[model samples]
Target: MANIQDSAQQLEEAIRNSDEFQNLKQAYETVMADEVAKKMFEDFRNTQIELQEKQMQGQEITEEEIEKARKVVETVQQHDQISKLMEQEQNLNVLINDISKTITKPLEELYGAQEQ
Candidate 1:
């Protein structure tokens, strides 16, 4: 277990140092450096969180709330800086998903082989 934990930590460090993560960080920093973009992003994030919380609490998300979120997304998408940041974020997510699949492959193989 200790060895597994150590390996997990190493993997985390590797991911932090990865190009995908670095690019994402750079893009985020670039967006944050612009006051207008930063504020817009913060506002969108806050609204998203509120919507998520409402959903989690079994509250209905009204059409107005949905339209508001859509407008925020549309506005952000129009900004080149935000668009690049979003692209970088998506790339980072893909890398993370690939890593997850790689990490789970051995377990999947073990179970699959036994069933065969």
Candidate 2:
């Protein structure tokens, strides 16, 4: 377990130093440097958090709330900086997902259903 923990820490460091993470950080910084884009992103993020919290609580999110989120997304999509940031974010997400799959592949193979 200690060895696993050490390896996990090393993996985290490697991820932090990866080009995908660096690109995402740069894109995030560029978006944050623009005041208008920053404010818009904050609002969108807040709304998303609220919606997620409500869902977690088994509460219904109103259509108006959904529409508000959609409008915010549409507005943000119009900005090149925000667009680049989103693209970088998606790329980072894909990288993370790939890492997760790689790490779990052995267990999956061991317990996976056998094909007919």
Candidate 3:
């Protein structure tokens, strides 16, 4: 229904204006402002994506690749701005997950499914 579309848009705007989203944006900007932190964060993210892609493609992940990813994560975790950014990201993910569960309640009710 058109009303549902409008409600969805309102939810989107609310999410965009949420504290979690704002904090995540600020933290991301802070990390990007520092060249070293940005590079380290990018490398870490790329390593994660590579591993996830391999997993999704049913390809074997080499021990060397795992070790490399671990090292990249460690290095990135040592950077304050990047660490802050990662924390904010986690917070935002939690908010999104909560919102998803809330929105899916009708389906759960229809199916008589117990809340997880």
Best candidate per lDDT, number?
Answer: 1
RMSD of each: 2.5, 2.5, 2.5
lDDT of each: 0.93, 0.91, 0.91
What lDDT tens digits, residue by residue, belong to model 1 across residues 1-116? 55988999999999899998998999999999999999988888889999999999999999999999999989998999989999999998898899899989999999899895
Q: Give stretches of model 3 more than 4 Å off.
A: 113-116
**Which digits, one per residue and each the tens of the lDDT, describe model 2 over residues 35-55?**
998998888789889999999
Error of 1 at 66 (Å): 0.8
TM-score of each: 0.85, 0.85, 0.92
Q: Say which candidate scores most in TM-score.
A: 3
Sort by TM-score, best first. Answer: 3, 2, 1
What TM-score does model 3 achieve against the real structure?
0.92
**For each candidate, how many residue pairs have backbone atoms clashing (under 3 Å)?**
0, 0, 0
Flag clash pairs in model 1.
none
Return the lDDT, model 2, position 49. Answer: 94
